[model samples]
Target chain A: MESVLEVKGLSKKYPSFELKSVGFHVDPGMVMGFVGRNGAGKTTTLKSILNLVHPDAGSVRVFGLDFMENEDVIKQQIGYAVGGVSYYNRKRICDIVAVTKMFYENWDDSEYKHYLNAFKLDENKKLKELSSGMKVKFYLTLALSHHAKLLILDEPTSGLDPVSREEITDIFTKLAQKGVAILFSTHITSDLDRCADSITYIKNGELMFSGNKSEFIRSYTESMGKVPSLEEIMVFIEKEEVVL
Target chain B: MGKLLKKEMKLTASPLSYWFILFSFMTFLPGYPILVGGFFVCLGIFFTYQQAVEYDDITFSALLPIRKKDVVKAKYAFVIIIQMISFVLSALFTVLRMTLLSEAKVYLVNQMMNANLFYLGFLLLVFAVFNTCFMKGFFKTAYRIGKPFIIFCIAGFLLIGVGEMLHHLPGMEALNSTSGTSLIQAFVLLFGIVIYVVQTLISMNSSERNFEKIDL
Candidate 1:
């Protein structure tokens, strides 16, 4: 099966933190949960794939195209949502939508409007005036409206209420049913269990596991004598330095 | 390229900076000379560019379906747009002054032309400064260097002032007078264009290298 996204040997170094060689891939029709700690390089990895942060060494291919060489084409097929999802403080929500619509060729205004209404967001409100959760909803609406084949979400559900999160999960599940791949990054294991088809865990900038969700959970259940949470498994891996 | 252009335009369409620039440019009117206009123009460019470079927006911008070259091109286009707007507005005010006051049209024209040249030089300098300071992962450095940069610019203006004061001493008048001639004016115009092109290329190369090296 063709992979929707492939990352290999991605490394980045900073004065205080270093993302060691990390690699992973997500096949089509899969919701790959990217689990990591607060500073475990998850955001950095996503940034690398989006060409937001330059990888010191390695390659990222999305939709069978080199990310750097074919960035525009890759971006066209990918939807991205960062943690905070900030917008111009002075712009009305509709204006922000309009600006985004102009850049994305596949933007669906009807879908965007529907999501805006679904989220109970006022089109006239300035972005700065919206609550943090509302901003995430707005970003998700924008991401979905672009007809993106892959959704790269970085802590997208962090601040949402359970109801809102469920609504968003339904959106992802629907998109996945239609064969859109999703790389949903979060520390929330329960959310991944609810929505992800597969799971990919990263620790200290290395892939810990990448496989079927049920099998991974079963394995953890068997080994730990209870179903270990994703966070526990990550801690175990870090303590033991488990390669697999 | 079109996508890049569109994105750049959208990014700049946020009206706050645009309005601020318009107001800053407008403040150079009524009784102000060309130096005030030039100062305001420089301030406007600095503020606008500085605001754009804040945070991960540049990273978000790089993530769009645009090439590194297109990113550089769009930035160049943005600079040109801002410069053109400020130039046009300043020219309009100068025209207003010429029409109403009627005493200093010739002096104002010459001063306006000189102001244009100074601005052209200022633009090149600012581009180079932005590239070396902000574009290459040195935004903090840029901010720090900015104070000294402004000091140096003031010092340079002071030297020009001193040179003007010495115009009566020797051959300085001849040099200043020749600066207004058709041939000399053409040379200055061409020099400005060449400098802009060269600085833009330098900025592009620097940005490309910076993008390549960035560990997003």
Candidate 2:
């Protein structure tokens, strides 16, 4: 398959929100930034893609296999991380890893230890005691150490300091270089400019833009008669009405 | 499923099982079976879904590779494990009491007694009722705290009411005797077992369907 992840015509309805015909794709060895404001259905879309949430319509395919039909086989090749690591909070980092590593058939112990050393993570500390940045690193380490070919991350660096954010961005790029497809959903536009090869913007549970990052910018520039960064465009979309 | 059970045991058994084992220190004393069995029954129903969602553990587990139904299945497996623990501890305590302190007659009193088949039946019936009430409310959404609480309270009150009424009845005292197991007692225990197995199957099926229809 050309794309490692493909979501087509996805739909879901909540009492107050809905994702209508939402679709996106990410090719191998590329990063697709899912950009949107808070409550814009970025997380919902990601969750549906990973089957964390059941969708009302459409389908998701990973590695050319139907996601719903081949959940185990498809998920074995995908590693998902939400905004933060939340599980067994009172357990030590190493203990949590020990329990979690058993779930993945291809868990690499040397890779896990290597990442721990590189990130300077203390294995003995309880998860509740770790800094938010360290928690993100721990999650990323788990995702990477499983030999996964795809990473679905929802706001992986949202609450981190600049140094941690930069470090995480570097890791995403490095993983992409190793032929891993990454679909990272974040509202922080600057993170995308640094690492995203393309952008998919969702607003009010709808896709407003999905294309080359430069082309998306140029379209807005031509329409508004001014060049705007992604952050400016997102703010304008939130604060004022604009045509996509 | 083995991996799923392993994860479930790691999450549910460690700390809770430790608490029960500590409680088992008083096992040789009478009422040991009822004590541990009651604790597990209450705890199993209470901890299934509401606690996980409240703690964001549901989100974490959903992000894992396991299917949604596997979560419900693991919980059923956990319940069986709880019952087995109660049984083993009860047997150990019963054997110890009989071997060491039979002359004291402390294990045969009305209020205090060693583990028996009747008590096992009572435990089974309680859990069977519990799963029926709880699985209905839990399958809707893991966050429906009020419904299951009300269900448990009603179940508890009814069982206690039955116990009180039996005390008032004249000939019912014979049912509590610690003599050879009776034919009627065997039938009651068999019925309780049937109910537990059937309710467990229904609970798993209902929960699987309920979870499938939900957004999360």
Candidate 3:
């Protein structure tokens, strides 16, 4: 398989918004940062790829296998973490894991225990008792414990403190080093700068760019006649569009 | 599907649902509208779905290595199990009312629906209506429960009212008999079981389709 994840011709329409043929691909061992402004269709595109939101038109391939046709098999190899995963506030972490681990045949109890200990997570704690950062760690722990070859995280670091964000990005870097392909959506460009090997930018439900992070930066410098941080490029484009 | 069903039972189901099975004993209550027992049992199952939504259970299930339709299937399975358990309890009380309490004056003179084989049939009808109306309506949005549940309450109670009124009709008094079963009572019981099975299967199919359109 050339790409760990590939999405093409993705489209969906709402009364007020439309995602028009968005496309992107992530190669194996690559950390691809999906960037977009609020309501820019980042979540929609990610959901479409996962078939959470049925795309009006598109095809998604994961590990070179058709996603829809081989959904169960494909999903087994993918670790999907939604932004704010609060499951049953009254249930303890071990109880939740007890229910979750049954679905995966390759569930690694030892790996789960390792992530639990490494993250300093108390398995006895209820979901409501955990802080926001701890919840993120817990979700990552679930995602990583199943021997996933691909990780798709939606806003994993949003609403987190700088320390927590740094910690998560560090984990992402290490995972990428171990050949686990990751596609993470975030508003935090700094996290991407720290770990992203490639970038995919969306604006108003359209694909603006999808390529090497340095190449995206170089393209912006050549056109604007100035070096710009990833954050600046995003802001500059949105601001420039309003001027037009 | 087995794993998903396990998740539904161990994770999403509420303890109140199991407790609500006791509602079947309302059959032993003299002169009261025992039909409401079936409605209360369904209400308990409704709480499970309500809690699932509050806890973002759909999103969690979506993240699992299973189809969205399988999530609906598991919920329906859990619901059927609860409903059947309630039905069995209600049937046991119905048998006692017919055999042991047949001559009890309070029951003999009761103007409401009697706990008999015919009543068992109507109880199944009540569950059938609940599964059809409530399950289909909830899956349309995959989140809202209040409206669908209210709709079920109306349908279920209306069925009970009809079941009670049938015994008052000039030629339908056999339906109110608290003793040995007649051919008509046996037929009604069989019919009720069929309706429960068929209606639930049809509702399950539509619910799975409606849930597929929902973007969790």
lDDT of 1 by residue, B94-123 (tens): 444434544554444333223333333343
Name the 10 consecutive residues with the lowest summed lDDT in model 2 chain B. Answer: B31-40
Q: Per-residue CA lDDT of candidate 3, range B18-78, in tens? A: 8888899999999888989999999899989889988888878887888879999999999
Tens digits of lDDT, candidate 2, A1-244: 4788889999999999999999888999999899998899998999899787889999998998899998877776788877665667767888778778887888899999998998899999987898777887888888888888999898988988888888888888988999989999998988998899899999999999898898888888976779999888887777875699
What residue pairs clash in candidate 1, if any at all? A53-B216, A54-B214, A54-B215, A54-B216, A72-B65
TM-score of each: 0.79, 0.90, 0.96
**lDDT score of residue A140 within candidate 3:** 81
Off by over 4 Å in 2: A241-244, B12-14, B21-41, B44-51, B91-115
lDDT of each: 0.65, 0.74, 0.90
Model 1 agreement with the true structure over A1-244: per-residue lDDT tens digits:
8799998898888788888878888988789899888888899888877776777899998888887777777787788877666746556888667756766778888888788888899989987898777877787777778878898989988877887677777777887998889998998776886788888788777777778887877778877888887667766666655598
| Top candidate (DockQ) | 3
Best TM-score among the predictions, by candidate number: 3
Q: Which candidate would rank higher by TM-score, 1 or 2?
A: 2
Writing each residue's lDDT as its tens digit, candidate 3 over A31-69 gives 999999889999999889999899999899999999999
